[model samples]
Target: MNFAFSLPLALAAALLDVTVGYPQAVYRAIGHPVTWMGAFVAALESRLNRPTLAFEVGRASGVFALALYLGAVGVVAGLVSSLAPSGVVGFAALALLASSLPAQQSLDRHVLAVARGLEQGGLAAGRSAVAKIVGRNPETLDEAGVARAALESLAENFSDGVVAPLFWIALGGVTGGALYKAVNTADSMIGHKTERFLAFGWAAARLDDLVNLPASRLAALWLIAAAAVTPDASAREAWLTVARDAGRHRSPNAGWPEAAIAGALGLKLAGPRVYGDRLVDDAFMGAGRREADAADIIRALKLYRASCVIQALALAGAALIAQA
Candidate 1:
């Protein structure tokens, strides 16, 4: 089936994404664990094997975990659907449950919190907030460093959190979307460059990259389009920056939106960053404009809002087309 329910389902998913993720900080404070046990198991599996063996085990473990999660979600959706007042209500509930489980809004909020902390001259708070979002050490960062990290995360996650799941949902409805989320969760938890995960997380990471490729590009395009709508945003700059710098990053996908945002704001981004004890020398994107600051953070938020508008419009249009 082409999943004719995709459009409304996607809308339901988006709403659920917002609702579930927004309340997480409160829920976390109350010690309600949002932990993905499946991801933890996959991570452990990677740690127990030799390089090649680890890779095999990790891949198998990740796939199995993801399959199990998706299956569970499906079963739950089926049960809920059977009990719902209408087929439409059942499908909507399924979509909401599937899409709401991903951490997009929560991730965005965490990044934004870091930026806000830096803006308020709360360097310590900024570092603490940033620590929650990224794998890198935050204690050594200055204001600009923290802002850069948050903005970069905003760009990268625009693809991961929003676009990737949306793409799968468009293709597969609730079940397909849930499967993508499980794979992505697996990648996030175990896909790392560390010795323990290098072998095991390789498949999950690579597959995530593959799935995110098109979505990332689309995110970049949407960002550029969104920038075009703003009074001072520059589409030409965004496009040129993306063209020149999008390929320079370690990830095939992250560079797209980062470059677009860099170009749109007429500022530079993606230089050296410290991850744990390691220093990563990354290529700079965009032409030299101004140093990153709180204003840039506000601009990033604007881009984020614009992206949401675009997503909503696209989903609406898709629904109309489907109905036709």
Candidate 2:
């Protein structure tokens, strides 16, 4: 798949996700026993002791998820294609592919849930939400800490949740899209700095980084463009911040968007946060506006929306060019 088809798929996916995702999530919640089974299986997988056993278990989990996702796509694509014209099948494939990708709405909802906990002054609730968003411990975070956690997640996931999947789908079709999701899921489940997963999970994590590189930079550029669109916003500042601070992040790819978002929002991001009992004094990104609150979260949400629009427009342009 190239931009010609991929653009429509991207748009369809974004639209479908925004319009129907909540209901679908609700329906899945109510109807799916498989979800419970998956959770149970994940629990079992998480508890494996031996490294070799863990690797085997991880591999099985990866293959299972890949097969299931791809199989579903194939079945759906076939059904849609059979009932309609080939063009319709193509469009439907795009729609189905889009449906698989996460949306800004979902991301905002999760972050807002955390913000609500923070506003209520319940550290535990806030911590729980933060933990869901980030890998860090919530127990040790302050208000600033919680805000940063959400912001960093917002930035990094903007690439992972939005950009990376679309990039793959456009490049390789539904199979590629599904494969990207599987790899990302594996990274989330097994990729960690913990002693147990250090060696085995390294491959998954590195592969994920490799895949995310271009998408991450694209996300950053989209963010910078978004910043330019805001009244009185400074593209120069955004560029400078991204250039200066993006490298400060631990992950090569993640810092790009985080830095861009911080620069766009004129806020500082990524400082020391508690991970379990240890404090990782990570380098901060951006310069102007360091202190964040609920309002900043709302701003980040706007940035998210703007970035999505930019991405869509870019895809559309690419499609038009291909046609030309």
Candidate maximizing TM-score: 1
175-253, model 2: which lDDT tens digit per residue? 5665676567657765777766665566567778888898899999998998877654567788999999888798889
TM-score of 1: 0.85
Candidate 1 per-residue lDDT over residues 1-324, each given as its tens digit: 355577677767776776665354755665222255354545555445455555567557555654555566556544654575557666765765556544567766777788787767578888888787667888878877777778888888888888877777777665566567666776787678887767656767887888888889988988989898876788889999999999998888889999999999888888888887898898887885646776788778887778777876888788888888
TM-scores for all predictions: 0.85, 0.81
Give the lowest summed-lDDT range of ten residues in model 2.
Answer: 32-41
Residue pairs with clashing backbones, model 1: none
Q: Give the poorly placed runs of model 1, Cα more than 4 Å off.
A: 19-34, 37-86, 102-104
